[model samples]
Structure formats: C-alpha cells, structure tokens
Target: MVIRYSFDSLQPRPIDLPTEVPLDDEADLSVLDEAKILAAPASRADVERWRDQIERWREEARSRLCYSGAQYDRIESQWAQTCFAVAQVWLWDELLYSFEDHVFTPQKFLADARQRLGGLDAVVLWHAYPVIGLDDRNQWDYYRQIPGLKELIAQFHAAGVRVGVDYNPWDTQTRRGKADVEELAALVADLGADAVFLDTLKTAEPELVEALERAKPGIVLEGESRVLLARIEDHGASWAQFFADSPVPGVLKSHFFERRHMLHHVRRWHRDHSEEIQSAWVNGVGLMMWEVVFGVWVGWNKRDRSTAARMLTLQRSLSHFLLEGQFTPLVECADNADDKLVFGSSWKRGTDTLYALVNRSEIPITLKPIREETGIVQLDLMTGAVAQHLAITIPARGIAAVMTSQGEINPDMIELASEVSAIELSDDARFEHRRVHRVHESSRSKNTGESGVLIEPGEYVLTVRYRGRETGMYDGAPYVDEWKPLVPRLHDPRTLERVTTLDNPVIVAQHEVTNDEFLHFVRESGYQPAVSNRFLLHVKDGVNGRGHEPVCFVSLEDARAYCEWVGGRLPTEDEWQIAGDKQGFQRLEPHVWNWTESEYSDGRSRFAILKGGSDAQYDESEWYFDAGVRPPDFSAKLLLMGLGMSRSERIGFRVAFDRRNK
Candidate 1:
C-alpha cells in the first residue's frame, strides 16, 4: 500500500532549483555554506565550467584556510568514508535495552540491524537530552552510571560494528563538570568509541579536537549538520540532515572537496525517505538509519529498506569505486536524454567505470542503453548478469547500477551480486505505525485505612498542559513529516483537553509519599526488587533524615510495590487531575513530580505521565526535561529507562484507591 501523503507541502520537489555560487577567484565561498544543493548548468558544455569553478574554489580555500588531511589519512579514521549506514539509536530503544528483563541486549539489537538495515557500520548510542536535566546529574552521569556499557560496545565491535557516543553541547545548565573538551575526550577513550556525534554543533572547537585526539588517536568527529569548509579537514563526517536535492542531481560540497569525507543524509521526522536515499545514491554518501527519533518512531517503509539493502550491497562491495574513483554528478544517459525523471552518475577508477541511477517517479523506467561507448563488457552489478545492450529497468523510486570493467571483477563484488539477487525488493511504502498502550498491572484490592481526597465517578473534561516536545503528549509523532521542527511547534507550551470517564470513585492522597513513609513500607514488607541498581539512592546510612520530604529515586515498580503494601495503588492521570481540582489536594513542600498509573508503551519506548512538576529546573536550554513547579493539570511524559536510570530525585509518587475496594 502506498501511504499517500495528504500534505502537498510535505511532497518532495523533484525539480527544486539549486543555488549557484559565483565562480570569481575572489568570490566569497561563505555563500555556499548553508546551500542544500548546488545548481548544475543545463548545457553539457557549461557543466565542465561548473566543475572547474568548484575545483578551483576548493584548491584556493585549502590554501587560504591552511587545511590539513592528517586525520583522514589514518587507517582508523578511514572507516567513516565507507560507513554507509549508521543508526542514531536511543540507548533504551526496545531492541537494544529490554524493559521487562532489565538488561542491555546487544545481540538482539545487532540481529535486527542485520535483518532490516542490512547491518550497520556504526551506531550513535544517543543518551540523555529529552530525559536529561531532570535533576543535578549531568550528561556524564547518564553514561557513567549505566552498567556494562563498555561490554556492550565490545559486543558491537565483535559483530564488526563500531559505536559512536553522542555529545550535546547544549548540556550546560546541569551539574558542573570538567570542561566540555576534557569530559568528551575522557568519555570517548573510556568507552573505546570509534566516533563522537556532536549534537547541535557543526564542528568541535580546535581545543576540543586536539584534546580528543590526545585521549584517543584517530577518533572521528561527526557534526550535526554541514561541517565547516576549513574544519572538514579534521572532522571525518557530517550528518547531511534536511539536505534538499536538485531536480538534476548535484554535488555535495564537502564530499566533492574531499572524497574521503562521509555524509549521512537524514531527515529525523520525515516518514518517506525516497528523496534522501536517491540523493545519497548519486553522491556515493551514507544514510542515517534512525527509526526511533528520541522516543518517537519515524520508521522507514519496506520500499525504502529494500532500496537501502541494494545500496549497501553495492557500497560495501565497491568502496574502491566510491572512495578512490573520480566521481561525476549528473552523468548523461547515452540514449534516454529526455528521461528527466531518471538521473545517473558515473564513477571511474583504474580500468573500471560504474554508473549509478535512480528513478524519482512512481512508474518504472527502462534505460535503452548506457556506457555503450565504453566498448567494454557492461555488467548489471545488482544482478550479476552480463548486459549486451546495457539496458535495465529501474523500479519506481528505486535504484539500479551498471559497471564496465576491463579487468577481473573483485570477489567482494561477486558476493554482493549473489546476495542482492536473493533479496525480494519490497514495494510496500506504508508507514509501520506503532500505537502507545497504557500498561496495567494488577494490584491488591484490599482496604487501606487512610484518609484522602475523594473524586466522584463521572465524565470530566480535564485541561491538561504540557511542554510540546519531540515525544508527543499521548500518541503519534509531534512533528509529522516536517523538515525541521522549530519554535512554536517545538518546546512550545501545548494544551490538551482529555475527556475521561471514571466508572468508580477514587481516593487520592492529598500529599506525596514521604521518605519516612516509604522506609516503613520497606522495613515492614521486607521487599526486594529484581534489579537492585539505583534503588533507594537518596537513603544513606540505612536512614533518610528528611522523613517529611517526598520519597524520591524510586523506580515505578518500587513505588508500585510500596503502594501495594498499603492496599492502595498509584492514581491514574485522570484521577490525579480530578483530585487536584478539589480544594483539599495539597502539594508537599520541595515539590517533585508524582508518578501515576499511566505507564505506556509503543513497543519501542515506555513512558509514564508525570504530574506536579519538581522544583529543580535546568535553565538556558530547552532540551532539558520539563522542570519548575507546575500546576496539577500539567503533565510531562517521561521516557522510562531500564536499570534504575528512570529513577530520579525529582520524581515521586502518591497513593490512590477505588472507593468500593476501600
């Protein structure tokens, strides 16, 4: 099924014109900085001139900026060039970290990558942010506190995949730590990470570059967007996010300047990826496989996955053609010159010349002849069949490749051909959507002799307020098929009115559960959790002096255990809000978020709605978790993490019971 995009604005502009940079010797190349696609001249004769002008600019720019290729020259750094696929994976993604088992399953993650994505070359283990700044624990603590993370990295290495650690420059308001340079350098070295993904940064400062090198030699730095021209010398790759392509395929500035430099094309929130995949195909660049964006699932369709499998098959086998070959954008088709919907590029190295083509339209296109003048044997690289006329069909929004070689073909190419022949390319372009479901756990229906606020049974419309973040309030993507979410759409004040009906009356506690109250439950019940990590972290010396303070640092399960002992359960989001609307609902001093019986899962992520915001607020950056004292109507969806990382000092719980049970 073709998932029709209702919004015409979200449709890809196949004929989007590119920006032209001046060719003058003294032309300010800074004009080329933010360009999505550089324009290629329509006439064949003028295309040569266009190529020369860009080459001349690169030569002069290098001399003027004093560029150095020392980093790319290293054997360890060269992997980025052929790193065709890198997954921007959340550390707690369901495939990688199991919520039920409470363990990091690297084997499970790797197996999924191998099947769906044709395997990953590297993965950015995205931790913190969207969940960070909940308390004083800084970014480093997020990594350092995780158990067996190093072993997890080793497992990926054993599977022949490198790991990349993410560094967020916007993480300043959290607990003070060593300088960013020192902290990041130490992190990369300790984890033995192959690369560092710089979040919201184009390039690391010169000081940071040097410090990271000193700590771990040959470490690759991959910036968020376009890496600066001069800084591209040290930075191995740039995430070519939101890069729009021309009607006719054009050159990627950084990749054109330095063939070894890698760029992974990605649009985090976009569901359809045909445009970006085609863009990467012609440019011989990589693709970022980020199915789960933060906590939201923006997965690739079957067609896109099949296209990636074919692309990766060719790319992994023919790295020499992509890296060492001379690349020419918009290579002309010998016979089908009028086929505007189909564009091709040629790469030449040694005695071989390869042509890569993409069909941008919805109908299959047949190429009459290609590279016939080469007069050498033309082989369909994808099928391993020799083509006498060099004619082949490129499926709609799919890719095709043909290679002519005067020498013996590499064994790897033969293996790639054999592998791709077995793959049944899927044409189903339907978005695989996951719906979030509220997880319900059975609690004892015993009577608890505790006085509390009563919420009558009725249908009520609650005005729920929350910060509009990438994690949507209840379900669906926050930014649906958007290029880049900005301003009012992102991190803006959002209001949602939920109409809920309660069948039975509820008794909600007026105040949060205190430290002293939780200790008594622990002592009396003698409860022990399946995973003891980060349990009762605030309680020290077998005593918590602050008895009146709300109990914090307890996981959702721990809170449930305490509530079960008292013959009550946590309040539902609706029950909590209804009680808060009453006059008797009093917030405990030193406010902390209250956990509700609102645990939800979309299979990829688990989250619980938190009410009554905490006093701790990390300022200066909007990426931090929602903080500051909020009204009872306010709710924050906190993505639940395994191994007690979900437990926070700023989050607590209170009890509620059904009136009939009490």
Candidate 2:
C-alpha cells in the first residue's frame, strides 16, 4: 500500500527581484566622503527643517483628535466649549472667593451651576476629608463637621458626575494600620463615594488593596503621592533626609517653586515605577493628583506662571494618556537621587507606540537620537504643539508626547524563513533497512522518481534535501543522523492491519519576521500591518539552537495576507499531500504534516489544519541518542523532504493560486 506525491502541480506565481545597478570604476569612494563633508552643515539645516516639517505634520495629524478629521474637529470644538464653560465657572468662583462677600460653599456653587456647564469627564471634590480614629481629629473632625458632605455627594452622583474624594492617607484617617481605617473606609463607601484618594500612599500595602476591595467591591481605588512608595520598595534608595536648622539656600528658589516641583516629583515617581504603576492602574486602581491647587497658587501670585501652567497642563494630559487603555511599560529612565533631571515613559497602543518625555531640570536635555522614519509625532502636551519629527529643546519642566499611528504596516509584507535545511526521504528497497538517508546530487537525481500534483500553476523555487547518518558510502552529505532507532515489532505480521499516512514534508521557516526584512517590505509596498492582527508565534524545536530569538505568532489570516502579497495562495490539503511520497509501513520521513487549504470541521474551528511530526520529543532513543543498528531486509523508503508546519512561533508558508480552467 503506497501513495505518490507531486510538487509541480502546486507551483505558485513567482515574484521578480529588482535588477542590480552596476557601479562605475570612476565612482571614487573619497569623492563620496568629500561630498558628505561638504553637505555636513547643509545637512544640519536640512535636519532642522525636517524637524519643523514633522512638527507641522504632527499638528495636522492631530487636527482631528482621534482618526476622523471632521469628527476630531467637532470633538475639539465641543471640548473647547465645555472647557470654556467650566473655565467661566472657575473664574467666577475665584472672583467670589477673592471678594470674600459671596455666601456660598464651593460645592454648592459648582452644584447649582452644573447644568450651565457642559458635562465633564469627572467632577473633583476639593475639600472632603476622611474620618480617622474612632475619636475624630483633624480631617476626620472636619468630615464629621460638614453637614452638607453627604448632600454634596448625592448631588454630584445625580448629575452623572463620578465624585472623587481627596483625602490624605497619613492624615490620621485612611492610613492603613490605623485604629479606625476600616470604619472610615466603610463610611465613605456608604456615602456613595465613587472613589477615595489615599494621598501619600504611593505604595499602599497589598493588604490595603484587599481591604478596600472587600469593603467596596468594584469601587475605584486611587493612591496619590510623589514619594513612589511601591517603586522605592522595589528599587532601594540610599539617601538620608535631614532637616536643616536654617532654611536651605535653594529650598524656595523662584524657579523651583510651584507645580514644576510637583511635575518633577510625579515624573520621577512614574519613571522609576512605570510597570508597577501601570499594574496598579490596570488592577482596579487609578492614579490621581492632589496639589492642583499649587498650579492655581502659582498662577495667581507668581506673575511668572508659564512653568506652573505647563506643569499642571502636562499632569492633566498624562492622566488622560495613562488611562486611555491597558498598557505595558517598555522603557523607563529617571534620576532617583536628584528627582530633578529625570523623564521618559512609553506604551504600546494597539500596533502604535506612544511615548512622553519631560524636562524637569532648568537645563535642556538632548534626547538620544531616534530613527527618523518610525512615524512618531511629538506633541506639546501643554500647548497642543504637534510635530511629525521632533527635536525641539523642551523648556524647563516641559513635556512632549510621541505617538505612533496604529495599524500602518501591512502584515503581508513581513517575510520569515527558517535557518534549518529541508530533508527528502526515499522508498527504494536498497534504503529499506535505513528509514532516513541523506540526499546528495546523485540521490536527488536517482529519486527524481515522479513529480507530485501541481497544487497551483505558476512558479516556485523548490529545493529537496535529506537527513541520515554519516556512513562510509554516504560521505560529504549535508546532515548527520544523531537519533537512535526503535526496537523491532514482536507481533505476528499477518494479524497487523497496515495504516497508511502522508506527512506534509516541506519545512517552513522559523518564527517571526525580522525588523530589517519587514522594513524592506514596507519600503517597497508602502503597506503597514495592522498591529491588532500581528502576533508572536512560538515553536519548541523550531528554535533549534537559538531559543532566545523572537517568536513568530501569526494567524491563518496573516499567512494568507503574506501569500497574496507575494502572488501566491495557501495550498489545499490534497495538494499538500500530493507533494510527498508514502514509504512502507506507517512511518513517514522528512515531510512533516502541512496545513490544508480546507477549514477544519467545516470552518467551525479555524485550527483543523494538520501540522507535521510532533515537534514534541517522544524519547531519548528515537529523537536524541543514535547507537549503531543493523539494516533491516524488507523495509521501504520515500523522498524525505522538510515540510512547513504552522506554529505560533514558526514562520512557514505553502504555495497557492486562483483556480483556472484547464
């Protein structure tokens, strides 16, 4: 019982590579160097111009906040109107407070005029303190004294404004390990508070998270402070705090005053512990700012409010940035000791990457060079300055955003290939005793036997090779067979029913498309792969020797996209079968199981396609060790060739095409 396979019928259309351009002998390398030198100054100017152009582009790109330009404009206009309304109320409240003659609490004034102001994302309650010890004191006393606190909460909730309470954890109220912490939390929850702030609890104990969850299931929890308690715990600090009897010289420097200091502190906290912060945020906790009042104070009294305003604006901007979606931090850089000269944070949004950098120190920091074509936009968080390419010097305590457009690269352009060579098996009586045999020039010619069905009609570069032990007769072969043989069967020959199977024999490349190769495809096609569609694939033995390499995680859709881009199509299961030969007995060599064009179980499950031999090892004898064994008498062999296998990490492909009448 033997079956034959063919590769010719499965041929696919071939893509032509670009012709090489010949260089002239007169083209002097030194002249090129001289030209580079001459263009150096001009290049600098060009770079600056390019930066400006990029900035302009970024501004244009952000003209429409999200993707739609018109929708972005509408949203922007609405946001402005809303902000203006809020600003008007804020201005009115400030004036009334200044006059000291207005008879209204902050809560009441904001509440009564809520309808006039457009809906806000969130409503911030400024002065609600928390209850501390069973015996009221400080903020706890204030909380107990305010008869209108509960009413304020109800009013805000009714207005669809999620109320956030501002309470310092160390203020003898919300602090964990305190006598009445649980009681205060319970009371706050009962009052219908949407969220509670534990100011200065940068690293609220894990138990505290559990306690809060238990007290108010699903309630948003937030930690407010710049000390970076969790980060500091993870990465130790080595400085002692000492209070000077006399005031330190630069303690209140004009440049260091106001929210700039706060910004610096916040940047440091985020930079040092971005991962932990992101984790906490995703795990039912929100990050908050308490010293927004500092911005107002700086703006009102300091005459020089630019820095303070920038800081406040950046903080608000970051709040929205971090809360956009779930993210994992990739890189972070910050100065822990000085807390001043630090800044940098980045996250992956879908397929796009977004990054932000802040200049906390008075001196400007030239950031490390970034690739020009990564499609990053530098946004001035404070002024809404957007630039496609950015190299501007941020003013002291300034912030800039770099966002990469999502889904710009085409997944079809990504090309992946395996390093390991394919092998071919044979079914001749001479090779019966030895299941695996190395394919050489002579062997390939001898086993040309017959071609398989042409799965599709076009062009293909198919190379056949084989794997076997190094013997005196087969010297100078490519691969060496290292695995040992299995024991001979003991059952009666007549009683056994022979089961036939065909393994897809073409070995596809290993996991993942390389950065360089992906870049080339993008350059040629101007196509961007959707970030959401791209994935990392993983394989066990596919790594072969390089286990640390990037994994290739792709879907059948991704595979189809690549084939279409390269003028090919996926192979049908029958077509894949026709490419490999069946040897005697149930054993098939070289040809691993290949994916079929047909959907599994009638497409109910997309993953029904067969994969080759178990990459998973069975035993040391057959897969690992190779002790000597004699050849058998009546065995059979077949062309053993490597076949592509679909794996989360292995990047392999099959031939395909549109069916044509023949």
Q: Could you say which candidate leads in lDDT?
A: 1
Q: Estimate candidate 1's alpha-carbon lDDT, on a 0 to 1 scale.
A: 0.83
Summing lDDT over every window of 10 consecutive residues in candidate 1, give the lowest-scoring window.
8-17
Best by TM-score: 1
Question: How far out, in Å, is residue 120 in model 1?
Answer: 0.4
**Cα lDDT of model 2 overall?**
0.30
What residue runs in model 2 are displaced by over 4 Å at the alpha carbon?
Answer: 1-104, 107-141, 155-182, 198-215, 220-343, 360-369, 374-391, 406-662
Kindly report which residue stretches of model 1 are placed more than 4 angstroms away from their true locations once superposed. Answer: 1-18, 22-30, 33-36, 43-45, 407-412
> Per-residue CA lDDT of candidate 2, range 1-662, in tens?
65343222112111111111113333322222101001111122243343333234334333422322221122211221111111111111232122223222445544433322212334445442110220113344334444445775676556555554545544432223444456556656666655554544533555654565566554444433222322222111111001010110111110011101111111111112222122222111222221112111101111112223333333333443343433322123322312444344455545555454545454546543133555554433323334555444444433434444433422211110010001111112111121222111111111111222333333333322212211111112111121111122101111112232323232212222332343344357755434322233232322323333322344454455554555544554333433433332121222223333433211100122333322222122221211111121111111110011122222233434433334
Estimated TM-score per prediction? Answer: 0.94, 0.29
The 0-to-1 C-alpha lDDT of every candidate, in the order given, reads: 0.83, 0.30
Q: Write the per-residue lDDT of candidate 1 for residues 495-537, one digit (tens) a residue.
A: 9899999777778998999999999888888988888778889
